[model samples]
Target: MSDGTGAPVLLRTDGRAAHLVLNRPRALNALNHEMVLRLGEALTVWESDPAVETVVLTGAGERGLCAGGDIRVVHADARDGDGSASAAFWRDEYRLNARIARYPKPYVAVMDGIVMGGGVGVSAHGDVRIVTERSVIAMPETGIGFVPDVGGTHLLSRAPGELGTHLALTGARIGAADALLCGLADHYIPSAALPDLLADLAALPVADAVARHARPAPGGDLAAAREWIDACYRADTVEEIVRRLLDHGDPAAKEAAETLLAKSPTAVKATLAAMRRARALGSLEAVLDQEYRSSLAGLGTHDLVEGIRAQVVDKDRAPRWSPATLAEVTDADVERYFARLGARELGLAGETGEPGAPGAAD
Candidate 1:
């Protein structure tokens, strides 16, 4: 199976399995627009192919499975209001994520290293999620003034109690065992054995590949800290949550609270609302659509610009958030984010090769 651009998916077929190795190690295989399109195309082909019984997705290096989207470009586009360009990236990326969720063929991801943000988007939704001791999974979007997109709400909401909300708001990192506990991974194997597993996957039949790659017993107890997480994050607003964390008298909880408070207040509130709504009412597609709306509209807002400026553009870590307190964020503000845009739609993609061509109009 060749990538449409001839860059190659590094595709190799054994008896009944195929392997898709993400090749751009330089940037940790971050999802550029082209890579996103290629992945969607590759998966579409494999889904229809009779001989392909299962597929394995992995990254190129020790750095990570992926570091998320190519945010440098996204930042540029955001500043320029490059909707025509950026919209294609998000639409196709979201479609690929949704496809992964619904894919029939058994899919596996070798989460060998750092798996954060968009990295979680691509692999976490697979049929068989594998993690190694090297795995470092996180949804680190709030730190950047962005909501966790890539169907993050679907997985995060399903996590124990408010841990999902805590992680989304705080952008905390979870190790392999903790990720497994959160239902993000199905197996745990030693990172040293990934090569052997890959070799087995590349040479053996689909069933044999799965058999050879069978993981060791899952490790550690991630649920031990669940009581603390739920307690610290249960408060209604960011300020309240911070106060609760401080009162808990746990050093880690206090540190997390301070870090979260330093982030954009509006982003924190909007993300919490998104997660809450995601739990009760929407499918992943609907969630991503809502996220896209927030992201699109957020670019012009104060937090996003300040966030990018403080975190990425300028080395200084101070961000001046508008309505800087959670108390300042109202239900009306949150609801306005979800309210229908007058005559506006995210205009999706179509099967045509021309990427910008919009899908059926809303």
Candidate 2:
């Protein structure tokens, strides 16, 4: 039975599996507050439903599962309105990410294509994550002058070697194999096999359904490049990291250096700090709390609005970052992003001190 509510998200049940479909194909299923609330409600219901043995998440369109949150709203609020609305939305959305992380039933995520930012939040944390040949996963918030949120810092911090740092500062996209190597996804199932696999999920156990479709992802760039990625990104500061990348003699490393130069200096610096702190914070909830602070801090910056204007609004492809270069981003500037939100805190990590993924060797 399908929950035909004519909403941006669609809910349905088939055999023992319940599906949560992101339905806004026109916006590439960019999640809004309403969809987040609906998803939370659906998950709450299905968590206790005796017949639902598996919960599957998929996007409605051919493009991908989800792009991310509705950032246009964030851009608007930051530009014209008080920051409260954006903060409220993030509060609920981050809570949903934590819920999905701890969801007890088999939570299966179909990560087929174009998943980034909030999309990574909803899918990467699931117990059963399936990526396809078409899958392109990233945490690309820095490009728009926002640090990665929704436990993205936590996930990225746990990737192999300095892979997390490399991705955090550069906003690099990875394919299925790299996603697997970085621990962002569990299996690689071809796009062609997805329909049949989804149908099998309706009647079979998640492990069984996935096993029938899973295959080795043939190509990945990260493993071969780990030496330079780890060495270059391990520096204490972004500027030092850039110098290493430029001097490393690999064309790819130089390209990464150029990529870093192009991002908002403030955002890239804050992200590096966030990723490092996330490694020590010791849990997803803690990292999310930190990211929330970074996000709200971003609301007060000129670069956040300007970066969005250049990249998304005006389509100019050239963002004039405040403070301009990595050298101008001071320690105080980066530290301010980690300031406490106090009463506005997400508070997901009650009593704190849960374990984190051990620091990857850099």
Candidate 3:
């Protein structure tokens, strides 16, 4: 479908750089199924085209690269229809995420604005992820009663120490430096220099073009809080983690505890589970398969519907999560999210059975 300017995703080639501009700026370039299909189709074509040396992804407006998936649609689907549409969207979207990770050519993501949820899926997996001072990246699904999907768990679970756990539970937004420290972004480019950088990409090799504009990232908050973050978030359970956070005597830690408490209880618990499982799942593809299970499971739950209504539809900012409190979210409740899906599986990992396989407001 058109986002007025063109397809939701606009594809073009300038010199050697193939560009995919996410066109839904009115919604901060929010991704829908049509955009996902367009992206996959473009990549498939570019992979075979001799002229396309690199794929560059950027969002249309100043707000950000992408706010996330077209979640308003997902909310409507869950509320008004059987979830097959949402499920199909995710199936293709996750495949596209994996494709970017494993893309034969260099894939550059211009993450200059708000990159969250599904936005992170598309960008962070790329060969080159460029973040600017304007970037605010997050994986905030827990707040809306959803588990992180599109390989988010794989990326977060692999982040140093307990930082990923902290991020997953709190649904926090991090800046460029924090993103780099967390292993989310590769290069830093000033937003002002982006126009010049794009011009260089058309003529120069990907690395050379990026190096011309990339600079050392400025420092950010996550580094200073690492000691407490590592110590408090190392717990085996979400309850224990919150207990540690509250008792740590650090105001930041206490605030984190409050944030965790405020999110959807079941989502928080299940997200914690997803992060931990993602670490042991061996490869990115395996973790994505696991995430598919978790995503579909969350799709069928009460909290998912209510959380969206409160956060998006009603704009209340107060989600009344089912099971209410973390204590009420039982082990079984969280485990249900990881249950297998058999024939409905994403099967990306299983396609080649190979290793070396490849979120924020995310």
Candidate 4:
């Protein structure tokens, strides 16, 4: 049931399976507040339905799974002097992410094409995550003056060595191989097989669906790459990450470093801090809570509106940040990013510790 706003993120149920298709192909199925609300409602219904045994999530059209959040909407809301709607939108969206992470039923994300930003949130947390040859997975949040939200910090932190920190700050796009290597995705099936696989999942029983999806090919070693990433991104500040990248001299590493330097400083700093803290937390709720605090504060402080203006609205590809350099970003600045909020704060009050939690690998 869509409101005819942006695009209808359709929810269909067949037998004991639910199929979620991101329908905004023109925009690469970018998520909006309405889509998030609809998805949450559908998930709520499916969660309690005894008839629904599994859920398969995919994007409509051939472009992608989802590009990210609807930046146009975000820009308009920011201009209206009230970012409350945007904040509330993230709160609900993060709750949805938490639910997906903890969902008991077999949840599979069919990442066929460009799966990025908010797309990562929707798909990465699934019980069985799938990727194809065409899958272009990334956490390119810093590029848009936003930290990787929607439980991305959780996934990023779990990547081998300092790769998480490198990716989080640089906003690098990884192909299917690198994505599998980083543990961002679990299974890899040929793109041509997706239709048959989807049909098989839809037709099978819960246990059978879980059994049918093929295992992922082994990802290459990231430890070798980590030495360079750690060395280049070693500085305590976002600026240092870039400087180290500049010093590395490797073409790929140099280009990646330059990319981070181009993004908003505050976003990079906030993301760095967010990923660091998320690494120490246990439950999904705890990470989401901390992220909520960071996101809420980001509405007024971070360069989201300006970033959107340059990237989406104007397409100028030039965003003028407030604190342009990482050195301009102070400890207090980063500290306030983690400050608590009243009334709408997420409840992460009593989480203790879980050693074998998802994001604690390195």
Question: Best TM-score goes to which candidate?
Answer: 3
Local error of candidate 4 at 98, Å? 0.4
Cα lDDT tens digits for candidate 3, 1-362:
45577778888999999999999999999899999999999999999999999899999978999999988899988889899999999999998998899999999999998999999999999999999999999999998999999889999988889898889888899999989988899999999999999999999999999999999887889999999999999899989998999999999999999989999999999998888878877678888877888889998999999988888889999887889998898999988897766678777667757442221000
Show the lowest summed lDDT stretch of 10 residues, model 2: 353-362
Worst 10 residues of 3 by lDDT: 353-362
Per-prediction TM-score to the true structure, in the order listed: 0.87, 0.96, 0.97, 0.90
Pairwise TM-score winner, candidates 2 and 4: 2
Worst 10 residues of 4 by lDDT: 353-362
Clashing residue pairs found in predicted model 1: none
Q: How well is each residue in 1-362 modelled by candidate 2, as lDDT tens digits?
A: 11243688899999999999998887888889989999999999999999998999999879999999988899999999999999999989998998999999999999998898899999999999999999999988889998999899999999999999999888999999999999999999999999999999999999999999999997999999999999999999888999999999999999999999999999999999999998888778878877888899999898999888998899999988998988898999988998776667666775344432122111
Per-residue CA lDDT of model 4 for 1-362, tens digit only, reads 23344447888887767988888887888888888888888888888998888988999878889998887887788866688888878977887887788788888898889998889999999988888878888888787788788888988888877888888887877777778878888878777777778777767864465457565654543555777887876567676677778878777678877787888888888898888888887556778777787777777764888888888999999898988887888788778777766556665433334432223331
Measured over all alpha carbons after superposition, the RMSD of each candidate to the real structure, in angstroms, is 5.0, 3.7, 3.5, 3.9
What order do candidates take by TM-score, descending?
Answer: 3, 2, 4, 1
Which regions of candidate 2 are displaced past 4 Å? Answer: 1-5, 351-362
